[model samples]
Target: MPVKIYHDEDTDITIVQSKVVSFIGYGNQGRAQALNLRDSGVNNIVIGNIDDDYAKQAREDGFSPVSIEEAARQGDILMLLIPDEDQQTVWNEKIRGNIKPNSTLVVASGYNVAFNLLTIPDDMDVVMVAPRMIGAGVRDRYVQHIPYPCFVSVEKDPSGTALATCLSIASAIGATRGNGAVGSSCREEAGIDLFAEQALWPEIMAIFREGFNVLREAGFSEEAILFDMYLSKEPAEIFERAADEGFVKQLKYHSRTSQYGQLSTMNRHDGKDIREKFHHILHDNILSGKFAEKWSNTKWAAEELAKEWKEVENAPIVQADERVRDVIKPDRKK
Candidate 1:
């Protein structure tokens, strides 16, 4: 089904302007959205928790930072831009009682709401405006007067204007300026995002790593392997061109030999089997709340993440990458 898009014309900016907007974190998304909103003429904006490095940075950026509970009490619209794992704890400890009745509670992602990780009050307006791009991308597009597409969802609407409020927020962040915002359900956004993170990204990384190992075993020089596999700009440039034009157009940019080889080998993988596996991972692991349950213990999650990073750092591919970089771009060596 085609999504209904909402643009600046469909949004009432005054609705968002009328409320005090408090960001509950000063992380990437939080800082970007807050700054964009302020620049877009949302006057009543504040940051929560003036204790961390991010909070100090927010203060330096001209935002008055308050505690989480203080922000919840002061703002009519409270946006939780913290990590997904931290949302439940923060909401339970600092937000629930302090959030005003009938006020709006916003989230950048639907993970917590979709998995029933949060218990939102019935009197509040719970909505989501998930940007399709990164926080830096959102800020860049806003400055250029371009729109970044976003997924907007209304999970609860105790206040009748919940959808409008979400659209208004999208407008402020330049998500409604170009092709406009795509209307979505909270569950759909959460499921897709989680699937991308858990299945698609890991699969891509595995392909790259295995390919690198194969080339190494074939006795290719580390520098040559690194450049061909990734480190060089060619792959990134091709992908960027493909995004701007079309994949078919991208194929035209390459030599006929390259195109023939790529097309011939593309179908070598079992597409149906791979898709079925993706479906299994998405439905059983992500949508079924199994992944969320595992990640609920933030401490364990952090340790696991650190362990993975350490493994990546010590991997042969990464070691080869470092050697190649040192030889070609020694200035980058720390």
Candidate 2:
């Protein structure tokens, strides 16, 4: 069966427009989403945050920012846009019992919900409207009337209309603009997000570091190699083209020799072992709740992370990269 994709045509935007939506944490994704919702004519909206700089920014943006407790009490829909690390703490301290019973709970990420870090009430509807892009891109695409990508799902639909409400939010946020929002679950969202952070980036970093080492051993200039590898933003341009065009289709922009070299050498690496390793990480750690459980030990996790970061700072590649930055990026911030 084809996965359900929600579009502006599929969603009744009026459903969300009529509801009182309170956005908790007026920063990052929170502010972008709230502004988009308001511009989409969702008039009954509130911004919730601590009395901080973010709240000040909200006020400057024509919103009357209120306390999290007050916002939780008033809204028919509560969107949790705080960082994943802080969600559980904020929920327990401010939102847990304060959130109105039977009101909808919305999250931009699936981390806490997928791992059951926050216990939700049975009477309420819980859903996710996770943007595939960053907050800035979400707002930018919406403003440009280009449909930005998002993963939306309703976890608990006690109200029976939760799916409709979820789609409505997605539409208002400009997620249904270009193509449509992909219907996905909290677990799937969490698994894929974490897999990229844990599985993919680590391997990428390894490849870069090893390549740097080989070039350095061959008497290449550190500054020259650093620029060639990443600092020149060549890979960033390639990735941008990959997103704008099809991944394979974007290869046409490269020199024929470059394309031929890449395509020919690609067959030598089958990636079967890499696929198996990725599957293990997905199922054994993220999907099976092992990583969440391990991370729940905040003190232990922080200690281990500190040690690992110390090693990262001490790594040869990072040290060389730092020296190269000092030469080429003299005005760069420390």
Candidate 3:
């Protein structure tokens, strides 16, 4: 027999919606999540920030905006959607001191709690409800009447109502719209989210950077190469495949002739030139203690990568190419 677990729409919404929910932080995850939660009729919500733009935005969107202390005091359910690194400090300074003894502390990711950066009081409820996508995708998917899947985990449920409350909150924020699947556990949810995030972006960036460098060293214009990759042929074809169908369906969309063309292109460009360097780099960075040291320091790897990207973006030919593309946007749309 299949495992019969507990969850459904009839599960109480007012349980969480009635609680004074305070969201701390106002970045990518924070902004989208706070607004989405409010839009779902979670009216007893407070955003923890004094003068931040998200506070302003939250107020405009019909949420109570308060200082972190006041938010913590007023909030029976405190959601920590801040960045991984900053969570500990925030918890120590703002949240831990002010929270009601038996209140709930919700985290979307598990870094601080998993790594023992933030230790919860034994009396409080600790749970996690993590959406499986980034901010834009999460927002867009919700707007499209497609609720993204979420992982709900209850680590320490003193009241035994943590799981139910989390599921209720999930339902409130469109987590059950189109094929919505919600799974259980704090450790499991945190681990999976962090692992996927840590692996995918660096791997893709390393691949792109190496490919761009190799093409440039081979005397091809980086602008020409990226244009072909992004706009002209490669991206267009990929977009066509993805838009027509899902990943498996994409293979069906490609004719045998198209398959042969792909094989030919791979042989000519990708197979011949691209090797295991990106994988090697990824392994080295992760294993060589470099990634750890960088993380432990006050460094932002994504920002640094963005600067390198901006350098490539600032190349004169690249600028001109972008301008030309913009000029033809109307034609492309037509």
Candidate 4:
């Protein structure tokens, strides 16, 4: 289905400005978005954070940050901007009970909602304004007058105005600046995001690692191969160009020979294994909620993360990376 896409003109900033928007968690996305909204004339915005470095940063940023429960009590619209894993706990303890019965709950990630981890009051509305950009990028683009993309969704609309309010928040936070805000669902948002981490990024990372191994086997210098692989920032430039231009059309920036080599070889390589791997991740893990279930297990998650980190630390690439990085970008344990 062709999804509904809302542009600059579709949003009314006044809708959000009229409501009290309390940001619960003054971290990356939280700080960026709250400042964006305040700058955009949403003066009634509130910052809710615990007594931490983030709260200190919030104070430095000019917000008189309050407790989560206090903010929840004050806000007509409460944005849950903390990390996904922490949301359920925070909601159960500080937000769900203290928040007004009809207050609208907002999130920048669909993880908790998509996995049914949050216990939202039925009397309240639930919406999402997920920016596709990093937190710093969100603020940078907003300040530079550039636009960025975001996903806006209304998961629950008790008052029937959840969507308008959601889009209002999106535009206020500069999400409607670029290609506009994509109207999507929580499931689609979470599924695709998790799939990229579980499937797409893993494949890309493995490709780089294996490519390094292949060149190493071919007797390439560790420093030279590492620089050529990524340290030269060539890949970053390629990706930036891919973002600015169409993925295939970005080939215009490359030599005709390079373009032909890439395009032709892309076709010659059958991606049966990759396709199957991605399908398995999407179907058996992401859509089935198996990944969420596993990750939600705190003990298992912590253990798995520790094991993965140890594996990565012991990987051959890490030593090569440290050696190359020390020479290229000098740093010390001191």
Candidate 5:
């Protein structure tokens, strides 16, 4: 589908700033949005969570800290910023009974609402404002005084002002500081986010793990490969070149045009395998126990992984890894 973004001029901020805002969680997006709103002069805001620490923190941040039911009852706009799995329980126990007929319900992610994990009441409006970045980036950029865009979707708006309400809330969270409004559907947002996460995250870890293992097994310095790969010495440089133009530009800059010169010719024969290989890796990993085992041990496993990662990160090969083109760029620029 064609992507459409809404600008500040297209949004109506007073539509939401006039209402009583309640954020249902105190996690990354939750805290970021809630605090940003409060800082933007949004009054009558409350933060609710099961955790005392979270509640206390929210209260410390100048928002009213209330029980979930109280927050839902008092709020004209309720933002569900909790995890997808916990949303149902929160709704059933805390929100369902307190939500007024015309109140608005908001979600940052579309998974629960899209997948039918949490069904809203018939009389209420449902909308989503999903920021494309991770929660940390959202929060950190906010701290750094930068802005990012948020994807918005109105699932159900009996009041006929759902779009306006969503935009108001987005503005409260400082989304207007950037490029602003983008149109999205619950299904589309959920599908694309899930697919992108699955494709980029686990596979990236797998590649890192295999590379580190290979270097270690080769009797080479683990720190070298780890630093080279993790530090992105080569990748960063290539990216800089690519950013200025394209991969070919990067290759030319590095005088490696001849090294990849034959790749274009080989594509006719090997290109067909890319899709098949991706499918095989995806399905095969699922069919095997490898995926599950990766997280099986939880605590101990994560520590071990981190330790290994740290070792690799401190490796010497990290400096000369061919995959890294501009490791110094990130290290020095940042």
Candidate 6:
């Protein structure tokens, strides 16, 4: 489907400014968004936790903090900025009954609603304003007056103004400043985001590790292997440039030999096979809810994942990375 992009001119900032906005968590998104909203002249704002360190920080930052239930009851817009794993519990225990009737319920991500992890009442407005970047990036770009494009979606709009409200919020957070915001569906955003996380990133990391290991096992020095694999800033700089400019434009910045080698050898990798495998993984794990089920049920999922990741940390490549960094970029330590 073609996406409709909305800019600041397309949004009525007063819509959000007039509403009482309450943030349900003080994590990355919460802090950045709440600050942005306040700075954008939305004065009726509150934090939904009163006991946590983040809550204290919010208070210190000059915002009154309340309990989740109170915030839900009082605010016209309740933005749930908590982790996906904890959203359902918070909704059932503190939000469902207490939230104002016909008010807006906002989510930064559509994971819970897309997967039916939480149910919304028909009387309320359910919407999402998912930023394309991290919370810090959102705030930084907002400060710089640059557009940080976001995905705006309306799941249930009983009041008939959910999309407008979403766009208003996006504008307040500086998402609709330059390039504006992309209109998308909750399911689309959730599926794409989850697929990227569960399939794409893991595949990339696996390829990196396997390539490094192959070179190391073939008698290449760890220092040389690390440099070629990633420890050097050259690949990182190329990727950073590619993100801002198109990959084709980025290619022009590379040496002719580098560009020719990359283009010519690209087909040597089994691109079709890798894509098929990724599709299978996405279908079985993400679309089928297997991954969510495992994550929710596994008692020590984070710890186990950390343990699994220790292999990369303990690898000789990383030790070589330290040595190389010490010589090439010693100031990085500070």
TM-score of each: 0.96, 0.93, 0.74, 0.95, 0.75, 0.91
What lDDT tens digits, residue by residue, belong to model 3 across residues 1-334?
5322334553577888788888887667777777677777787877888587777776776766788888888888888887776676677888888888789988887656555567688888887777877866767776677756677667778998887887777777667565554566655555555445566654665666667667878899755766765656775676668765764457556689987887677557853233464444445654443454455333575677678788878654466556667665747646
How many clashing pairs does model 3 include? 1
| Residues 115-173 of candidate 4: C-alpha lDDT, one tens digit per residue | 99888888899999999878999999999989888899999998999988998899898
Q: Write the per-residue lDDT of candidate 2 for residues 1-334, one digit (tens) a residue.
A: 8889887899999999999999999888998999999999999999989999999999999999999999999999999999887788789889987989789999999999999999888999999999998899888888888877899999999999999999999989999876899999998898889999989998899989999899999999888888899999999999999999978888999999999998898868899989999999988988899888877666777898899999899878899888887777788876
lDDT of each: 0.88, 0.91, 0.70, 0.89, 0.73, 0.85
Which rank order by lDDT, best down to worst?
A: 2, 4, 1, 6, 5, 3
Residue-level error in angstroms, candidate 1, position 305? 1.0
Which whole-number lDDT from 0 to 100 does residue 90 have in model 3? 72
Instruction: Quote model 5's TM-score.
Output: 0.75
> Which portions of model 2 show Cα errors greater than 4 Å?
297-306
What does candidate 5's lDDT look like per residue over 71-94, in tens digits?
A: 888888998998665677678878
Model 2 scores worst on lDDT over the 10 consecutive residues at 293-302
| Residue-level lDDT tens digits of model 1 in 1-334 | 8889898899988888888999999888998999999998999997997598998889899988999999999889998999999888899999988987788988888899999998888888989999988888888889989867799989999778899899888888888987889899879998999988888998988888889898889988878887887777898989899989998679889999999899888857668877998999998999899999888778988999999898899888888877877888779957
Overall local distance difference test of candidate 2:
0.91
Per-residue lDDT tens digits for candidate 6, residues 158-248, read 8999989988998898888888899887788888998898788878877777787788889987778777777667878988899899876
User: Which 10 consecutive residues of model 4 have the lowest summed lDDT?
Assistant: 325-334
C-alpha lDDT of residue 36 in model 3 = 74
Which residue pairs clash within candidate 3?
Answer: 153-185
Give the lDDT of residue 51 in candidate 3: 84
* lDDT (C-alpha) at residue 82 in model 3: 78
